[model samples]
Target: MIQALVIDDQEINCILVKGLLENFFPDRIRPYATSNLAEALELITTLQPELLFLDISMPEMDGFELLQHVRKQQKAEVIFVTAHDAFALDAFDHQAIGYITKPIVSEKFVRTVSRAIELIHQKTNTGLVETLKKAIITSGNNQDKRITLTSQKGLTFVDPAHILYCESSGNYTTFFLVNREQIVVSKQIGSFVSKLESHSIIRVHDRYLVNLQHVTSYIRGNGGLLVLINGKEVPVSVRRKNDLLHFFDE
Candidate 1:
């Protein structure tokens, strides 16, 4: 069972989160909630929970302020719950697992919590490792040469030339190679864009980060489709279509 905690200023909000956890997770998660920040701080130290559902609009110190205190005790997968969308970027900056807006929609809550659980599994189990795990990169003469991919099993050094494309699922990115080998890493596709951009890797879609070196053909459409060297077809989003075309033109 996973130990989880919910901290909210409103008693009703705390109850709602606790209820939702019980309904969705049932036997998987053992949840505790508190409306008092002081009590919540004590609980963080005492429980040392693996999952935390924190509210951002609490009195005195908000969720972000509380996170500063919580981090000192232990590392927990934090999902920020708030009615304000304004803090979404800040929450992501703090590396929170998920940011949930107020008046919790069950479907959205389930989806967000499901992702948090997946990340937790990745951290605790041998799944995808930690999402913040660094990808050591080597670049020479202003060119990216290699990327070190780390996994629970071991580390694998990959050459940019050999990479075909990368696909993103939630927080994980899977690198597909020319040899049909796949390396899964616990990092977002956006994290790798700057590192691999010099080596002809680019984001063609929200879910796809591709190495343009391996693109064999481009089939035109609204955003169009890309035919890779290995005969894999990848979608090109309309937003990034012009950028891709410009790359091709160059």
Candidate 2:
């Protein structure tokens, strides 16, 4: 069963959302709702829900702020709820998967939730495939030999130690190597995190993931910059600076 959460300052809004979920998706979803911001955050941590219905305007903090906190913990698909249309663009700016305005229409709500459920199913299936692939590849002592990557050309087995960094451009990720070689793959940078992160590859910014093994030096600033072995510099986000430092501290 998929876990779902609803967050709103107004008790009625929470109740209404929960009711809608119960009515439309009684068997598929295990629904929870909260009007308190503190309780909502706690629930998000504990439940690690796959879907979140969040009210954009709230007393303590808006949905966007809460969503940022959620992202740090889990990859919950968000559906922003608001009374005004102005917040719609802002919701998309935050990369919310769906947005709905009040008073909620049953048909629209069903449509949006249907899409979210489909996406969740797709991710679950993909995860299963990846798990099987990893099991087959890591069956022997050759586990650390190479990581498989798919590009426009074909599948490439790469040595993780040779990777300098990975850069993201929209949906594409370009892998840069220590030998000045580059491989472009048609997938989000986040998709490769699990596969490459074990090899000292860490995301330094939204657009850049760096291999600490190849980092020559770090230049400090607000966020900072990393000089790689191949004389290439990668900018680190301020939010991720402490993480990079802590990695070295350990």
Best by TM-score: 2
lDDT at position 225, candidate 2: 95
TM-score of each: 0.53, 0.56
Worst 10 residues of 1 by lDDT: 131-140
> CA lDDT, every prediction?
0.86, 0.89
Please give, for residues 1-250, the per-residue lDDT of candidate 2 as tens digits. 7899999999999999999999999987889999999999999989999999999888799899999999999999999988978888889998888999999999999999988987787677557647756886778657546876666465666889999999999988999987787999768999988888889998999999999998989999999999987788899999999999999889
Write down the lDDT that model 1 would get: 0.86
219 Cα displacement, candidate 2 (Å): 68
Cα error of candidate 1 at position 175, Å: 16
Best by lDDT: 2
